[model samples]
Target: MGNANCVFCGCIEQASVGVVEKWGRFDRLAEPGLNFFNPFAGECLSGILSTRISSLDVKIETKTKDNVFVHLVCSIQYRVIRQNADDAFYELQNPKEQIQAYVFDVVRAHVPKMNLDELFEQKDEV
Candidate 1:
């Protein structure tokens, strides 16, 4: 059972219950009815990096140097180690918009830095 004051419970009640995956790691768990969350559970995800707390994810796709048109996806996970739920919510907008903006900014910054030939020639550099 969760306390009425619990943010998780409130979110479940007021909004839709959605599963949030950490960096595409862990089977997305129900957003509702969770009691205390242990960071140890983070290990359940083999390739995904779990944050000590809940985090945000960002993904993007772009073409390769050879114009190979490769799809690239990236995710960034950030958690509030301070345990301030209010602060986290206020600082980071809901995942979708925030993630889109972050991915775009990151991709845009990196794209210009590399030339088509550079990307193809230095395959391992990136």
Candidate 2:
């Protein structure tokens, strides 16, 4: 996709949106389907962002009240909202990294106050 030519033709799969730029600036968005653009006119397809649900697991290590080191794996489900597709494409440099940072902060704050027994008992609750 880095290589450019006079005319660029591409397909955006279902549940995905294409980010288009003109003169290296945001021009418009391309919905799922075949799309055509004239790159010679300073137009290009910058990226494709998915609008479907996605998930990831973030692991964090923290110590409990008993000084026992516990490793926690948290599953996070997320997606780019349809209405905020532009923000998702432009605002987030690394979406997963930001999410993991947030989750790590939250878990690190709470886990220190809990004992090993409580953490084990509330495994499903977590």
Candidate 3:
């Protein structure tokens, strides 16, 4: 059974981090490369998180002040700060959904007040 426990070894890739948990609670972050944990001792690799930059595209549909329907694609780029890896992992269970809500709120609030040309000209400001 001792040898069987070694099967839980995990190979973490470059630019990525491993979330280690002890007895089902977050333990620590493991660096890239081979990492070993003993499940027999209640230690395991809970998840893998990327330190590299990532981009998310959110589509928004709202109306202009002139009542023109417009669809916009907003690209949001983000990266996990290695120092805050734990927060990134535990802070929000559904970040994408929360982000979508924020984007939707901001666009919906601003778009309805701007004319089509104003929206086009000052989109970056919004």
Candidate 4:
């Protein structure tokens, strides 16, 4: 009864792709245009899921050599790079999680090598 637009629907609907599945295990045709669907639907849905490139923004604070604290915000965008859509989804949950894990690892690996002054000077390198 809820007529909700596809969460992935956008102006680029033309470029949209479809995923064939059952419709909530309910043996009923919810909509038209479904290519492949399980007729006897108990708890399944035929839908198209979209995977898009995502970015994560992280802010890190460190003290400067002059004893002043500074905060740095880094925005990083990363995609699955892999062409396998299913594999990418199975491997990477979402953009935020990927970004947080990657950025944290990167910052941790390099932060200790530099002091506050060096950290400030090399901020852009990150």
Candidate 5:
């Protein structure tokens, strides 16, 4: 028998929330604090989801419209919406990779249409 008073407790660290799944499915969310759940029964799993604003820098190498090969470093800042923390955590297995992929896609799509000189002149527009 599982210990009655030995239930698992999780602590959602500062600037982060928690996603609790019951039997391999999402059940609810736990805000930052001491969260309690049953672990011995294998009924629940909790994962911490960060809600802090963070930045990602991606280095992409691509050819410009002028056929100039260039290396560009793009930096973006983002955060998981507090109310959408569950979706962010569940929908994205690796948030960093997803962000990087999106950055690469956007940069490649826009940069290739502009010459190197235009790219520098309209950096903010891109």
Candidate 6:
């Protein structure tokens, strides 16, 4: 016979939040600090979902409207929305990669429409 465990406890760091899942499905969000869940025969799982806002820097080589090739380095700040933390974790296999893909798409679509001079002048706008 196997020993049965009843309680599982974990801590969420101050800078991060957590997600709890049971039987491979999302169960709830855990706030910072110690949290507990029923093991229910080893079906419960929990871990940190996200910390504070994270920054991603991407370098892109693109052509301008004037046909000039330019290199751009962009920094993006993002976080998993508190309400959608579960979706952020379960729905997306790699959130960082997804954000990078979106960033590349947006830059490619818009940067080519602006001249180098326009791009430099309104850098913050982009």
lDDT of each: 0.43, 0.85, 0.83, 0.49, 0.80, 0.77
- Candidate 4's residue-wise lDDT over 39-86, tens digit each? 343223333334446667888765444555667688886554323533
For candidate 4, the per-residue lDDT at 86 reads 35
The digit string of per-residue lDDT tens for model 1 on 6-87 reads 1222223222232333433434433333333334443121111123444445455665534554455555555543334333
lDDT of predicted model 5: 0.80
TM-score of each: 0.40, 0.79, 0.82, 0.52, 0.82, 0.85
Q: What would the TM-score be for candidate 1 when compared with the true structure?
A: 0.40
Worst 10 residues of 5 by lDDT: 1-10
lDDT of 2 by residue, 1-126 (tens): 343233488898999998888887778888899999888788888888899999989999999988999999999999998668878888888999999999999888888888999999977766
- lDDT by residue (1-126, candidate 5, tens digit) is 112223488677899887777656677788888888886555454567688889998999999999999898888899999899878876787889989999889988999999999999998887
Point out where model 4 deviates above 4 Å: 1-52, 62-70, 80-82
Q: How accurate locally is residue 115 in candidate 4, as Cα lDDT from 0 to 100?
A: 72
Better of 1 and 3 by TM-score: 3
| Model 1 residue 90 CA deviation in Å | 3.3
Ranking by TM-score: 6, 3, 5, 2, 4, 1
lDDT of 2 at 91: 89
Regarding TM-score, does 2 or 5 come out ahead? 5
TM-score winner among the candidates?
6
**Residue-level lDDT tens digits of model 6 in 9-86:** 777788777777666666778888888777764445455666588999988899999999998899999988878887
Spell out the clash pairs found in candidate 5. Answer: none
lDDT of 3 by residue, 1-126 (tens): 012222368888999998887777778888999988888878877777899998889999999999999999988887889889888887877777888889899889999999999999998987
Evaluated at residue 101, the lDDT of candidate 1 is: 86
TM-score of 4: 0.52
After superposing candidate 5 on the true structure, give the runs of residues whose Cα lies further than 4 Å from its correct spot.
1-6, 38-45
